[model samples]
Target: MTTKPYFLLCFVVGLSNPVDAMYYVQPWMLAVIIPLAGIREGQQLLHELYLLKKKSYAHINYHIGMFGSSALLAFALEFSEFLLVSSTSSLTLSVSGIFKEVVMLYLAVEYNNNQLNTLNIVGLVICLTGIIFHCILKFHALQKEKPVNTDLVVTERLLLRRMESADEWSVDGDSNTRRTSLDD
Candidate 1:
């Protein structure tokens, strides 16, 4: 019933697909698309010329500047997201997106003076609590799965000891009597 195997299979298929290599050409695609989009927008603006005529030259220039700046920002954000997904994992990207939303919500509430009703506040708290618990569980899982290094290195002055089986030492035995099977 679990989707984990399906997800893994999809991931493997995605990696194996030769067409996926085209994702690396995203910058080139953007270069071609942006100019085409700009031309389309320019045509739309010309079609709506009457709306532009009422605005002063300075006002038009300021709005155009703001639009261009926002477009550039959008490009930067897209590129960064592409890099993030390429470098890390989809799960990391999803987690970061959630974190970004949380931060934006907090900023809106604190700096923009946006109001959240009781239900919204409660939902946000629950989301944060879930994220915290997820991180704690992931940390513990990783710790448990880590491979312990049992390889021994010899040096001239230092001696290394290896413990025997877990049941070798009896818990009820006195400290002096407690020893590993290797001691015998």
Candidate 2:
């Protein structure tokens, strides 16, 4: 299956977990994990390591696939959490959920297609269970956290300017209408 969405989900969720706190995760993590995964994936495809036999390779795939899956799951959970913190649900959550679920299901189907070992199957199940709890807890916590209304002053200034502009425009328009009526 196409792995793009899965990776994107993981990237977003992982990033969300911290960014909402105003503490950014180092971009270096992306700078590192992605290239590393790509390199390893390439190595696995091009040259078979003697140490990883046929069975061992399956384990490798399972482990890597599981990690990727977790990343996707975490990304989704983080997004939901971000929404929860906002204390209101809207179109945003719905769309995000749909995207996350579709990719998750796609990866799951691909993982199953590979004739995974029992260990891999078990790992997937366990990880899925953990993800469920993670989403629930994170979202709950987000709802509890208060959003920073730090921009109130700036917002007030902008609103005041807009209101003054609107008043000026309306006064001009009204005066023009009055002048036209008098002439008539």
lDDT per residue for candidate 2 within 1-184, as digits (tens), equals 2223333343444432335432343365577787778877976655545546556566677768987998787776775555453443433454455566557667767976645578976886786666666667767776898977654335555767888666544234436332343453
Error of 2 at 25 (Å): 10
Off by over 4 Å in 2: 1-30, 33-112, 145-184
- The local distance difference test score of model 1 is 0.61
TM-score for each prediction? 0.41, 0.31
State the displacement of the C-alpha of residue 175, model 1, in Å, after optimal TM-score superposition: 72
The sequence of per-residue lDDT tens digits that candidate 1 reaches over residues 1-184 is 2323333333444432323433444577789998988887977766557657774566677778888998787766666665565554455655776788888898999999999999998998898788767766766776678654532122211222233334455565455346655876
Model 1 worst lDDT run, 10 consecutive residues: 151-160
RMSD of 1: 17.1
RMSD, every candidate, angstroms = 17.1, 14.7
